[model samples]
Target: MDRHYQNLVQKLEEITHLNGVMSTLGWDQEVMMPAGASEARAKQIAALAGVIHERMTDPALGDCLNELKEKNFDHLNEVERCNIREALHSYELETKVPKRLVQELAELGSRGQGIWVIARQENKFSDFAPVLKRFLELKTEWAQRISPELKPYDANIDLFERGTTMDMITPIFECLKQELIPLIEAIQSQPLQPDTSFLQGRFALDKQEALARAISQDIGFNIAQGRIDVSVHPFCGGSHPTDVRITTRYKDSDFIESLYSVIHETGHALYEQGRPHELGDVPASESLTMGIHESQSLFWERMVAQSKPFCSHYFDTIRAAFPENLKSADVDSFYRAINTCKPDLIRVEADEVTYPLHVILRYEIEKGLFEGSMRVDDLPEIWNESMQKYLGIKPPSDTLGVLQDSHWSGGAFGYFPSYTLGAMYACQFYNTLLREQPDTKKNIASGNFAPIKVWLNEKIHRQGRLYTPQELVQRVTGEALNPDHFIGYLKTKYGEIYQLG
Candidate 1:
């Protein structure tokens, strides 16, 4: 039994290494690879996907799993048992999907992402529609193959967030929509709004980059272990804990966009860097889910960076970096500007109060696409209509509308929900953090994020996939996943900002 377990671990480690290589290649494609390399890169990704699929579905792994389960399952330690269980779950699912489909999807995703960049630049959805359609079709087919009993969309949702489904997410989104629409309407009706005009102007790209790098490190994203780069959309990806890579794009007109993106991606990098180092290339050391992963990013971006305490601590440094832009801005106004509640065209740049509505719109559209109620050709119109209906704003171009996000081009269906789910999870975890450490805000105000990072690492990061997201939430917060905590948080924070009585 021990021999079987060792062999299984060895195979799993090899797979993990291969997956890491794939991630590195993906990072290169997005950040470093030239436009002409798209075709070759797609083929490379396809071949690697085929190899990974073969290894994942290997019969030797199945044999090891079976022997361990039958012979010494009861004798295995908790970590060992967890690894075995997750490996088996993945093996079973991977075996059901064909290698051909896996390769096709991988290739399409690689090619589509490059095309998406070009199409977005040109503001033409028509150029990317065919790839988008084929990617969706392949993903739907892949989902059906793996989970025949589930609705195709539900199966895709499970790919990113295990155990989550439309039935589970719909009610939460509906609750948010019900509560948020009136709040937004009220805020919009206010006679006075923060003058964020100071945030808009020419700022040197090098200065912005320097400021972002300094702030990310100050917040505990280790510069020695990770790096920051430029990409069309900001993201954090790396081969391992010690090699994390994060990227953020700069806008000379607005430093806030680049700065917040760095903060958000740093949140992700910190989680990657904080995973238990001893448990290398194993399931137990992996992130629990996309929702959990998103929670880490949002926790910093919204719960910390957007807070008054953070603004108070960091305003001087920021103003010093861009003296002309922020010379007249005080901490209070800076906090309000960062937390401004307004509808926006870009989902990534949307204010917190209106952000979830953007996600909900994407969720609805994804649901519609998989359910056969929507089509690729209809996306721009549908997106525009939904934006108007939800936020009382309509996008004038496809780039700002359907093409704003890179998720679909990369075959990331059912991923948008993770953002909102993560926001809720972050709130729950943060509320617990505050309860345990009453000085959390003070710590932020003093620019001492060590306590916050240490707490998160101890409570969330090191555990890895040792617990399901639901179980982890319960263990950390002493309650089930609840939307009320998130809703209450929004009301309390934004109410004070908008003076809603």
Candidate 2:
């Protein structure tokens, strides 16, 4: 190994340790921290961010990277070469923004999260607007500093999923809007609908937790290494892959929210757990992109957990969880209730048929915000209008409208598209998985996910950041991201449920 490369690797390890600390703090802030501790936590996060920024932008790190790039690399392996390449990319992007700005952004993110929670609870968008406006201002400035060539929104998008742009995403979404509107209308016009009454009964939280945990464990989430808890919003975050933490809020009247939140986040934990263990110390070992990461989660939540075979396999468990309520419920009705399509206010709770519409709504609003056509104060109105136009429902309050999501408060512009993109990717990947493993449905029906997990690990999980999202898609499915697979999946699945032609 070259001396400079070794130094670079060592530096990255230090930076990763700091990141681990920051992630721990973040998880604590969301799940366990007292309200009185918010201010101190914000300062701690900001100081850590400043130190990380200084280290990442250090001129010596640049010199080391340049030395490695300038020297002969004939002796190095692929991972070594990738490390230097990824490090150079990170250094360039991080150096663009000033350290002070980075610290300010981190501080604001922490403070904004607390404010957003309060505002949403109170149904008051005004309470959070000023903080959100400041966040947008900082994010826009940071985007400009990073790359003036790329549009401000695209610059932020690249941070999550590189090689993606509005030019590419716009048409894909337009295609979805064209196909889905008619499909939704057709379903609504149907004479018969699924019996969702079985799902409206009181479900015990302890039983829900047990079911969630059982399913999470059955799908390869190592409980010994991971823990599940409740949060205001469900999320998966941990300091290390070995210490994976997942959270889902429970509602006594609804169980799917907690059950599927576990399944969805377990998919994320699986990807995090399956990351190349050999390269754990390198930044290259992290999941490649947010889109790819979301694909894993959506795969489990939609393609696996929501499938007929899965329902057949797990019906008894669900029935047992609520014996009094589900006494009359059968597997078919249970499946339909779980897959029922109702255009709703919440994105996280949306059914598969209407899920992408939620993402599309956010995508358009984000475009307006970044393009200067939309103002912060107008978000609530725009949100209500879009809901009425796209989903045929209007949010009566900001709590269920503009204040519903926690992304903007955290300054995560251009991140919503990943959810829809991931759904498409998951569908395409499922097509190939079924083709390669003919007994996959049988295995899933029999409570055997080893085959499914093994296949995903071989095809997607172990690759880590070695390939971009597009490259990985091509390598696995032999094509670029095709939304037709997702549309076809929805059409076929819903056609069976609603008897649509």
Candidate 3:
């Protein structure tokens, strides 16, 4: 490698480590920090982000990039060229924003996350609106810096999934809305359903914790390298890939709440753990996008964890975790409860069949937020109206509704579509996996995830940011990202449960 390339790589690696520290602090704020530490955490995060941004956008980095480009004016080696090109791309993007604006965005995001938690707990949007306004205000400024050519909303989207614009997402949303509403309506009309009462009761918190750990381990999350904990919101976050940590809220009345959530986050953690060893310091090792990452989690959570095969293998272990509480809860009932299709207020626990609709609703609101078409102050009314139109049930309050997610408060406007994108990718990936490994479900029934993990590591996890999300999808499925595979999988799997038209 050229001297310029080496220097740029070192700079990026140093930045990566600094960013990792901020990530650890942020993770603690969300999962383990004391309630009063938000103030200190916000300052620390903003300061670090400011320093990182300044360094990334430094004129010296641009000079180094120019030097490297000049060196390769004739021809370029693939690896050396990719490294310089990636670094230069990052520097150009970072330089687009002023350092002070980046700091403000970070500060607003951190404070907003804290405020959002309080609003969620209190079931009030008024408490969170101020923070949301500040964050989104800065978010608009940030979006302008990234891609002045696109609409502000489209620019924000490219942050999460590179190359994706609001225009691209609109059709994806349209396709889903066109097909999913009728499917949800059909499921609503069906009489058949699981006995979800089995999931609820006065189960002990200790039992929930124990079960969470066991399920994480059973699903191939390394007990030595990773741990599961509880938080207000269920999520997976950690400082390092080796030290992956995840959290899920437990409802004493509902076992599936914690159980399936663990599996979901575990999916994310496992992907982090399994990223290619050689690409550790390269962007290639980083996750491609929020949506692509979500598919890995959902693939394991829904396609595998909730599958009949997985339940058949682990029902005894599950029963053992809460034997006293579920002595009479048959394995079949627990399985059915998990797979039951229903429209629910909570997005996290919404049945897989109805989950896409929740994402679509969020996408609509988020697009409006960015395009200046939707006012932050009017969010509650818009949120409720959209929910009613989509799910036939509207939130009576903001907490269970507009204030439910932690994303927007933290300036993640373009992130929601990824969940549905992920679901579609998950379904498609699962189909491709099964086509090659026909007995994949049977192996899950027997609790052997090694083959599946190995398959994914080879095909998906190892590629990382080396390829864009669409490229990765095509590489894995031999075609571009498609919803038909997702819709087909959903129908084929849930068809047995909801018996679709």
Candidate 4:
């Protein structure tokens, strides 16, 4: 390799390490940092963001990239080729935007998160409105600056998942909404739902934490490299391929909150740990889009963790976790309780059958928010309307409605669609997995995820940014992104739960 390209790769590695640091600090702020450290953390992050932006957009970096653009440059391997392509793409997008804008957005996003934390607690949108509006303005400007050829919204969506656009997403979302609304209504009228009484009671934190650790181990998350903590909003974040950290929220009166969330966050940690040792130029260390990442967590959380076979195998472990509370609880009863088909205000807590409806509602509003059809201040009213339209219930406060998610507050405008996209990815992957290994359910039921995780690592996680989400889905599933798979999954699963006659 030419010294130019070599230097570029080294610089990129440095940038990635810096990014890992930022991730660590961000994770700490959420899980372990004292409340008074918010301001310092924001500035620290802003500085890191500025440094990263400078490195990414440097003229020398652009020159090295231009030099390496030739096909024969240094006889570039596939890894180098991918790195150059993605790096150039990132460079073009970042350099076009002003550094001030980059720093400004970072600072704004940090402050906005703080405001969101407060506003959600207060259940008042007014406290968050001004920063939210500022965030949108900055985001719109940043999007416009990056790709003047495309609409700001489409450009923004492309950031999370490559080549994804409002036009492409709109039809898919339409199909999802069309199917989900009636299905939810029908399921709502059904009588054969799971009894969730087993999930409610005073679940001790120690037991829940112990259960979380055991399940995390079962699912291949290394407890030594990763640790679980409690937080207001559950998430998994960390600095490097090793040293992964995740958080889950607990309700002493509710078990489901911590139970499934641990599984979901563990999905993220496993993927992170599974990243290849070769860093920088290799696509393996690079995570796929947020949507694809979510699919990993959700697949483990819903497709495996919540499956009937799995519950039976682990019922005794679960009972042991809440031995006193679940003295009379059994696998079947626990299964019915967790899969209970009921509408709820919180999206995270919604039953699997009604989950996509929540996604549909957010997708519509997100589209509206991006297209200037929706204003930040009007979000609460619109959220209530969509909640009623989709879920047959309304949130009494914005806290349970639009303010529930930290995505928008963090200046992530085009990320909401990924939740449903992840579900769709999960369905296609799950179907393909069943076909590939008929014993997948059997293995999961036995609390062994090694074989499945290995398959996913080789076929999916290992590919990482080497493939776009579209290519990843097609390659793994032998099919394109199909909502039919997801719909079928819901119908089959819910059919059993609701006994649709």
Candidate 5:
């Protein structure tokens, strides 16, 4: 390799290492760090952020990238060229934003997370709103730095999902709002409701954890490389593909919650594990977008784990885990129970039929907030109002409402739409998998995930960031992203479950 290529790769590796350390620190903060270490963690994260920013914005790196972009650059293969191009794009984006802003955001996020935990537990929005406002202000400034010509919300969305814009998503969300509410109303009008009473009783935390781990393993999570742990909020993160870590919070009253959380996070781990190993630390080797990443989690958590076939296959293990709680409930009842459609205050716990509404609410709130029509102080009241308007339910407190998600606490604006977008992607991908391998449901029913995992790894996970999400969707499904796939899936699945037309 030429000197320019070599230097670029070396610099990229160093930047990747710094990011890996940040990921590890982030994991620790969420999973293992003591509450008292908040201040130290904030400084550590800020220092790392400053170092990474310096490295990313270095003049030497810029020179290397400029040289790589010169005439006759085609000596390198397509993948290498793509990596270089992506690296340059990232470097330019990073250079546009001041290092001070980056450090401030990092520190604020670290400190805000601890405060968020306390504020959530104490059910006090007042304690957390200031930090949230400050984070938003800093993030807005960062977005402006990255793309002053773009709308702030679109610029923020670009950070998590490149090539997506509020204009593209708004109409999709509008279509969903137009269709989903009526579909939900039709389902509610039905006399036959899926019985969910069997899921109400207490299930031991230890047993729940064990069952979650076992299911995650059975579905192809590599325990040697990855492990599950408890956290205030469930998430998946790691320094490298070979060292994945996932966490889930348990509720004694709801085994399904933890189990699905594990499944969801395991999906994320699977994607990381399946990434192309040959690419090493190059940014192009990372997962494509947050939307695609969420697609993986939702694919497992809903399409597989919540499916009737999977329930039939896995019900025995669940029954064995909590015999007392589930003895009288058969697989069919349990499936219906798990799939029951009802509007809920909590987004994570929302049933599939109503989950998109939760995302839509957040997406709209973000659009309003970034567009300057909404203020941070009004989040609680507006959140409650939106919940009532969208889901026909209201949170009793900010903890159960405006403060529910960890995204805003970490300055993850424009991230909520990914959940619903992921659901759409999952539906499209699942349809493709079924068409390609007709026996997928049968294999899942038989507790054989080898084919499913292989399909996903080959089709989606292994590609990494080689393609934009839209390009990937078109290549995989012969169609671009269309919410119709998700809407159709929801209607068909829930129609059968609710006996609605």
Candidate 6:
């Protein structure tokens, strides 16, 4: 191996280690940190962010990368080339922004999250607006500094889903709206709706946790390497694959929320655990993008868990866990109940057909905010208006309305589009999986998920950042991202469930 390349790898590994530490702190803040420690945690996170920024923007690292790029460029293997390319990309972006801004963003993110939590619980966006406004301002400035050529919002979107822009996403979303709105309207107009009354009753939290954990393990989340906990909002986060942490909130009245949150997050953990273990602490070993990461989660959540076969396989276990609540329920009713389509205030709890609309609503509001057409003060009204426009319903309060998500609190301005994009990717990937395997549903129904897990590991997870999201999608599915796959998936599944034809 080249000496300069070796030097670059060592430095990159150190940065990755520091990043893992930051992630650990973040996980603790959400899952285990006391309420009183918010201020200190913010400072700690900020100081570490400054250090990571310094390491990322180090002059020595740049010199090494330049040497590798200009001199040893063609001599390196594909993996080495990929590492150098990704490293240079990060170096260029980080060097463009000041370390002070990075620390401020980090501190603000930590502080803003705590504030947002209080505001959300209080059902008041007012308490969170000031910090949200500041976070947005910093993020817009950060976007401009990193990618001056693009619009601030575009740059933000690119930060999460590389090479994606508003122009590209708008049409896909429009297509979804075009198809989904009418489909939802048709479903609503149907005389008979699925009997979902059984899904809304008090269930034991302990039993819910046990059932979620058992299903999580059955579906391939290695509990020995990872653990699940409770959080205000569910997420998959940890310092490394071997120590992954997943969290989901539980409501005693609704086990569905926590159970599926575990399923969704378990998808993410599987990806992390399946990454190229030998590539330790380098960009090439990281998941490609937020879109791809979300794809893995949605793949399991929507494509696997929400499917009829999955419901058939797991319904008995679910009923056994809550026999009193589900005593009269059968697998068919359970499937239809869980798959019921309706407008909802909470994005996390939304049905599959209505979920993307929630994402699109946020995407539009985010664009408006960055484009200066909207202010933080206008969020509640605008959120309500968009909700009504998109889903034909309005959130009665700010908590269920503008303050529902944790993304904006943490300066994740452009992350909304990834959820919908990931849905499309998930559908495309699953279509390919079904075509190849031809018995995936049968296997799933029989509680045999090894083939599916092994396939995903080989096809998506193990590849890591070896390919871009676009490249990975094409390599696995044999085409570009076609929103039609998602639209088609929704239409086919819902059509059957609703008798829409």
Q: All predictions: root-mean-square deviation over Cα?
A: 0.9, 0.8, 1.8, 1.6, 1.0, 0.9
With a 3 Å backbone cut-off (N, CA, C), the pairs that clash in candidate 4 are 194-336, 195-337, 196-337
Q: Candidate 5: what lDDT?
A: 0.89
Give the number of colliding residue pairs in candidate 4: 3
4 versus 6: better lDDT goes to: 6
Model 2's lDDT to the true fold? 0.91
Model 2 clashing residue pairs (backbone) = none
Stretches of candidate 3 exceeding 4 Å from the true structure: 73-79
**48-70, model 5: which lDDT tens digit per residue?**
99999999999999988998888
Off-target runs (Cα >4 Å) in candidate 5 are none
**What lDDT score goes with residue 6 in model 2?**
89
Q: Each model's TM-score, in the order given? A: 0.99, 0.99, 0.96, 0.97, 0.98, 0.99
Model 1 local distance difference test score: 0.93
Q: Give the alpha carbon lDDT tens digit for every residue of 1-501 in model 6.
A: 889989999999999889999999999999889899999999999999999999999999999998888884676777888899999999999999998899999999999999999999999898999998898889888988999899999999999999999999998888889999999999999999999999988999999899999989998999899989999999999988898999999999899999999999999999999998688688888888888999999999989999889999988888888888899899999999999998999999999899999999999999999989998899899999989988999998998999999998899988999998888899999999999999999999999999999999999998888898989999999999998888888888888998987
lDDT of each: 0.93, 0.91, 0.82, 0.83, 0.89, 0.92
Judge candidate 4 against the unseen true structure and give its global Cα lDDT, from 0 to 1.
0.83
Error of 6 at 426 (Å): 0.4
1-501, model 3: which lDDT tens digit per residue? 467777877777777788878878878887889989888988998999998997788788888888887774446544455567678788888988898888888888888888888889898899888887777778777777777788777877787777887778889888878877887788778887667665667777788788778778876788787768778888888766777889898877887788789989999998988876465475656777898899999999998988888888888877777777667777677777788877898899898878988988888887777767989889999989988898899888888899989887778888888898899899889989999999898888888889999898889887767777887889889999888887877767767776666
Q: Which stretches of candidate 2 lie over 4 Å from their true place?
A: none
Error of 4 at 417 (Å): 0.6
**TM accuracy, model 3:** 0.96
11-65: candidate 1 lDDT, tens digit per residue: 9999999999999999999899988999999999999999999999999899989
